[model samples]
Target: MPAPFTADTVTVHSPATSANLGPGYDSFGLALSRYDRVRARVRSAGLNVRVSGAGADELALDEAHLVVRAMRAAFDRIGAQPPGLELDCHNDIPHGRGMGSSAAAIVSGIELARSLSDDGRARLSDAEALALATELEGHPDNVAACLLGGLSISWLADGRGAAARAATAEQLAATGIRPVLFIPAEQSATRAARALLPEQVPHADAAFNAGRAGLLVLALTSRPDLLLTATEDRLHQGYRAAAMPASAALITALRSRGMAAVISGAGSSVLALALADQAGAAAELTPVGWECARLEVSSGARTSGA
Candidate 1:
């Protein structure tokens, strides 16, 4: 039999994530400082949900809510489910625009479920939790980084999600790397952006991305000078450029100014890997009506009141 719920309330703070990072498509991801906070409580008979901040107006308040769905999935995996749930979501990450908002929600839900169960941590190991989150999110890059923090490299192993942290928080802080984001008012859907790619890319382009992806690991961890070259990608960005013309043009312009820049994820947001001296210049390039923010690399999701 499964262990009963021991905690009446649980809170999870999940970080936003940026995937692809230019050349490591579907493999590399970085956690950003922005976060979404969810507080879940057990109830005797009814479900209640409240939302504030980003997506508050449009997001569903019932069982159809993404966080609720993820919590239910985690409860199923743990062999138990609470009678009812009350959720309070305070969101900071924007919806869509390739910022890993979905991944954050999924991660938060799984963590909440685990925290509420007396033996949930024992039943669901970290690897199992990650796999469950990946299953719910349909990809590992964003969820892996949101769960593990810093720089993460994820892949599929035996049809399950597997990930490892490439750069430690200390290493990243020492490099003084700042991620400057330029977010457009318009959002781009990941499905639409993915459909723009061809079934097969040229061998030469594949080789190019492989080389750059490897260099990206080194550049992000140690050699900051190589970032411009390391961030180069020919596999997916060009193919999806038409879907986010403004983003593509902004990346081109940033690179021309000797800064390392690339499309954040699928598109419509640009990420520039800037140093302390370069962050200001990168922000200045943000076009009118676009939102710009400079953020630091963040730690993984945190939980309280478990």
Candidate 2:
């Protein structure tokens, strides 16, 4: 008879992530339509990796890769050597495009580790798994939205994920939120984008962001009708504009069209939209310098096709 689970492989699906949700800066984020895949199967006693898709041409599918690093760390947590392994990947999310491609890999890799702990099965509590995954991914924005689906408000401590302080799927579900993604043919280096900002902002700028930040939460939660009012940002967007070649043009175009958009995390990809009816035609605009993809916001990042 064939074994019920002979493969001894754990295939984890991770959704693509968009961090720094326009006004949220380090505080806000959303999952997106893109994705990547990771399949881990056990072998005798060595490690092997394979890669294909979006970033494959540039990414290392070996020990030096970020996913590999997270997997190894998970093994260390369990105090065991992961059996020889095969990791097959498909990278739908482009690298360095301000999308959470790397974070998804980290979360998927951690799931692989957790599976190894349960004698090759995944049995970690959702909360525990969430915390562990966030630690491996560094920060809660991407990991939180991916794990729980929908909108998540999480806190991280010492590089570990805290239980969601609050989750907003209920609120987000009450109304529809569509996303307009201006994916340029060119990708932005997250690190370079970060380098564009000053280590500190003037007090006035910081204070102004605080007020809008509050409005952002309210708009997303209790009153999405105010999304237009809520989308205004003070902290990261304007500052990042100087560095991101495409920022100003995209934001202006989106607003002129009555769409709500903000930099979806230190980005070149400007995520925005008005309503579902508008999304279809809006996607067709494709400004002179950008490639646009418009998708209504789903509760969480997508993984079925990853």
User: Poorest 10 consecutive residues of model 1 by lDDT?
Assistant: 1-10
User: By how many angstroms RMSD does model 1 differ from the true structure?
Assistant: 1.6
Best by lDDT: 1
**lDDT tens string, model 2, 28-54?**
666665667787766766677888988
RMSD of 2: 3.5
In model 2, what lDDT does residue 56 have?
A: 76
lDDT of each: 0.91, 0.67
* Per-residue lDDT of model 1, residues 90-145, tens digit only: 99998887889999999999999899887888888899999999998888999999
Measured over all alpha carbons after superposition, the RMSD of each candidate to the real structure, in angstroms, is 1.6, 3.5
Model 1 residue 88 distance off true place after TM-score fit, in angstroms = 0.2
C-alpha TM-scores of all predictions: 0.98, 0.86
